[model samples]
Target: MSVHETIEQALVAPSYLAGGGDPGWVTVPLHRACDWSYGHDPLMPRVILTSPDQQATLRIDPDPDEPWWTVRHARCGDRPAWSATFDARTPVEIIAALTDALTAPTPPAPGLEPYDLLRQAGWHTVGEGLISPGRIAAIEHYGGEDGPWFADARLDQDEGGLIWRAYLSNTTPPHLIAAFAQALADPTPVRRPVGRVPAPAREHTLTRTVHLPVGDVAFALEQRVAALSARRKDATSNTHPPRSPRVPPPRRTR
Candidate 1:
């Protein structure tokens, strides 16, 4: 199909996790905000972003056939290391929240605790996990000398198992973890059409049909693209100014 035709078709059923939205919502913003080195495979259309320190990596692969590993993040740290993966259907909005949290320059907000944040957000303990108010989602947390603490989201479960999940590693800045806590805690209903989402998801996630405007998401995405573009423009202009003779620092001699 022609590109124009494809765009029209997507407009009719533009729903979160329905496979029509662009992953750039998460990738582009994070790239510009964190200044991660970016690489792409034009043919397969995959995006791989590596942190400047090379301690973290984010990969977004949208191919539905490869659902086992769609959006993945990994960080290598001192004592413990961790990796997070989400299925192909996971919403970019949710992932963006975690990445957005990482953009903050300050240390983790005062008095921010992941478990307490979850509890305040209406989740309660169930043995080793914390179940959401809707009971469709749960969290598995672990910590000790062997491993650092982490709160993982397992959402939209039924007989089919974990529908989609988000793993934010403990090493992944504490403030970012708090960002995720706020994201998952948000009561805002994700704008997804009933038929477009998974059957199991609808069973537990069904709620009042609140027709919400998704323009904010679209606007935010456009803003990210513009911001990234402007920053790159400034960088390019600065790097290649008219002409300035290069001078090396005097050689050090012992």
Candidate 2:
């Protein structure tokens, strides 16, 4: 079978049990763990997810020249609109954190200190950004107090190359950034295919494949379709009331 088939049968997993850093780590939960409406096309290697309330959206595209993941929210009440972006190659676990936080049932508490959040997650100061315990990933702040936030995984090769990077405007909610910090500090290894994983993750010992039945995604999609159908049926019924039974002219006795 093809490499895609092999990946579908059994997912590359880290012994630690957390999701592997593959793009699926972020994609699966957005559908399985949240109530986002999902859309995709086989002709395209991307997925678009919209919030149930229609106030927010998430997109995943693996094109190397463009952002891989992007989240945008519409202004609601007192909450200001915002956006977050992740470049291709960004660790899947990192992006997953932001999604989990974004879709949380309850809004994240306000007034969180970014520094404290990172500290709580066990990330130590390394100048502008904090480094992961494994020292493979790093999240930095640049452009002074008003600059955007960044996250990247890098390797010190012959010339030192970056594995991936992510950006978040300073206006991004603090809660989302906090979630990112926690994920960055997590010691668990993310799952990844033997040949397709980023160079940084591959430097570590790999674990056995884990069964992530593809049925789960299908089931989630089924639920979404059922919900949409029910809503549409209700709408149609309400708009066009049933017609009264037709009555024949007084018996054709004539």
CA lDDT scores, all candidates in order: 0.56, 0.64
C-alpha lDDT of residue 101 in model 2: 75
Compose the digit string of candidate 1's lDDT tens values, residues 1-254: 33222111122211222332347777776676567788766787677888767766777666655443333344344534555566666666656676655443334547657668779977898887677776655556555323433333334334246556555454455566566666666665554443555654444443444433455434657777677566656667877787778899999999
Candidate 1: lDDT over CA atoms? Answer: 0.56
Q: In model 2, which regions exceed 4 Å deviation?
A: 1-22, 108-112, 120-122, 133-135, 143-145, 157-160, 193-196, 204-254
Report backbone clashes per prediction.
Answer: 0, 3
TM-score of 1: 0.63
- Residue 160 CA displacement from its true place in model 1, Å: 2.0
| Top of the candidates by lDDT | 2
lDDT of 2 by residue, 1-254 (tens): 33243233223333222223456566555665455788768899788988789988889877767887888888888977888887765666677678767766555667546666656766677887776555656678777677778876555433246666678877777788778766665556554444555434544434555644455533544554455445546656877899999988886655
